[model samples]
Target: MVSVCRLVGLRAVARHAVLVIALGTGLLGAALVALGVVLIFATDVATVYFDWALVALGAATFGVSLLGVFGSKHESPPLLRAYASVLLLLLLSLIGAAAALSSLGEARIDAWMEEHWERIEATTLVVRKDQFEALLADHVAALLTLLACLVLVLTFDLLLVWVLQCSATSRHRRLRGEDVERKPLRASNGAGVELEAVAP
Candidate 1:
């Protein structure tokens, strides 16, 4: 009885955790979509291709969050597993992209920024080349701070994914345990003997 109560409590806690993960993922998706929209219309920092990628990523994230919600509601191990796997893949891809970008070094990043600034300056009279160069000089510290924040956020996301996976695994184990328990109960009731007699 104690083990059963403990199992129930753990299951409840796991369900609540999964719900929180779904909410977090949904908010993340909405933020990404909003950022993409803002960038596409109000800023020249991102190209059209990059803007679309952000929006697509947001949509996929929101969809996965919905999957997690349903999975948790139904206590379906398979759906939860699928949700965790897709989220893990997305996180890994983001990490890889970040790694590749960082490996390009400051010179490559500066060149890319200069190229974009020139394109923006050509199209608009608001920003001058000298002013942009000065701005870049001043923003180096800000850029580094942003990089640090990104690392922290990635670490937090990894922990969230780990929690989600553990919840799925625990649910699966509970299901298997229940099945095993039922098998012995079935034999204790002599149902197998009855079935065997009928078969013969």
Candidate 2:
């Protein structure tokens, strides 16, 4: 009974991990497509480079997730671990990229303000400064949102990896006939009869 329970638990964990990987990859791919569209239509050439970088990262993550799913199907621990490691590396890369883009944005905004202070001042007096500030805030907010999404996806991927590792370990142990707990059984004898109880 205990062995059956463990087997069922292991299968459930593996299935959950695969599902998470698949969903994360699909969502990341769609997000990348949307970001690509936004970059082409809304951003300038200078910022477009960063968007391209993010698109590549997203594509790589999607590929890794698919690989993880396939590896899990084969019940290959080494392949699953490799896929997980790649995902961790990709997550780190995304963090670095987000930090770099934030720094670049700050520098660009400072430079823009420095170069167009006089024009901006005149325009502010003639036009509604609130509208301009709102636009700037919206852009920054969107960037932050994207970063948050990346972080969340990375976290989910890590969790899936952990679950997969645990399940794989359990399965390996079971395959090696190590699932049963063994212990010395106390023996009793009465009137030429002997009995022993197994601890399972």
Candidate 3:
């Protein structure tokens, strides 16, 4: 009984955690899409493609987050698994992006920065090429750091998926056990009547 109660508590906590995460992710995704649209029209950075990419990624994130929200709310195993599957794909994409960035050379980075600098120069306080290089390096480092953090978070999410599955399985097993116990009681009562009739 204690163990069952503990399992219920853990399941409830995991479900709430999933709900909170889904809500937060959905909000972040919406913000990203909004920012992308704003940048698409406002920025002179010739990064229209990048902005579109952001919108696409954000839309995908929002969709998956909604799936997770609904799955947890309804306790639907298939939806939960589908959410986990999309998350895994997202995680893989991030890893691939990180790997591609890792191979970026200093010259390539400098050229890319120079290409965008003219449009951004007026807004940025930076004047020297060296300053631009430094800022670019910092940005790359920050991106790598953020990716690392995301990887950790996604790993935790995978664990949460397992926990949710286990909770569901255990709950189902408990209900079946109760049904089995009731069946035996009925069978025993029938057997007792039969024995009494045979004794007569």
Best by the TM-score measure: 3
Candidate 3, residues 79-165: lDDT per residue as tens digits? Answer: 888988887887898888888778876678777777987766655333566776787677987888899889888877766765786
Candidate 2 runs further than 4 Å off = 1-11, 23-59, 101-105, 108-138, 177-200
TM-score of each: 0.54, 0.52, 0.66
| 1-200 per-residue lDDT for model 2 (tens digits) | 35754977755665566666666676877688678667767865324245666677677757776777776776667877887787788778778877876777755865675688667655333335556555665688587678879788777767666677777777888866643545446676866766776666
Please report how far candidate 3 places residue 97 from its true position, in Å.
Answer: 3.2
Who is ahead in lDDT, 1 or 2? 1
**What is the alpha-carbon RMSD of candidate 1 to the true structure?**
7.0
lDDT of 3 at 125: 37
State which candidate has the highest lDDT: 3
TM-score of 2: 0.52
Q: Which portions of model 1 show Cα errors greater than 4 Å? A: 1-11, 31-51, 112-200
lDDT of each: 0.69, 0.68, 0.76
Model 1 clash pairs are: none
Error of 1 at 145 (Å): 5.5
Candidate 1's displacement at residue 61, Å, is: 1.8
lDDT of 1 by residue, 66-171 (tens): 8778777777767767776775676676567567666776688678777787666655435567777678667766765665665565455445445555766776
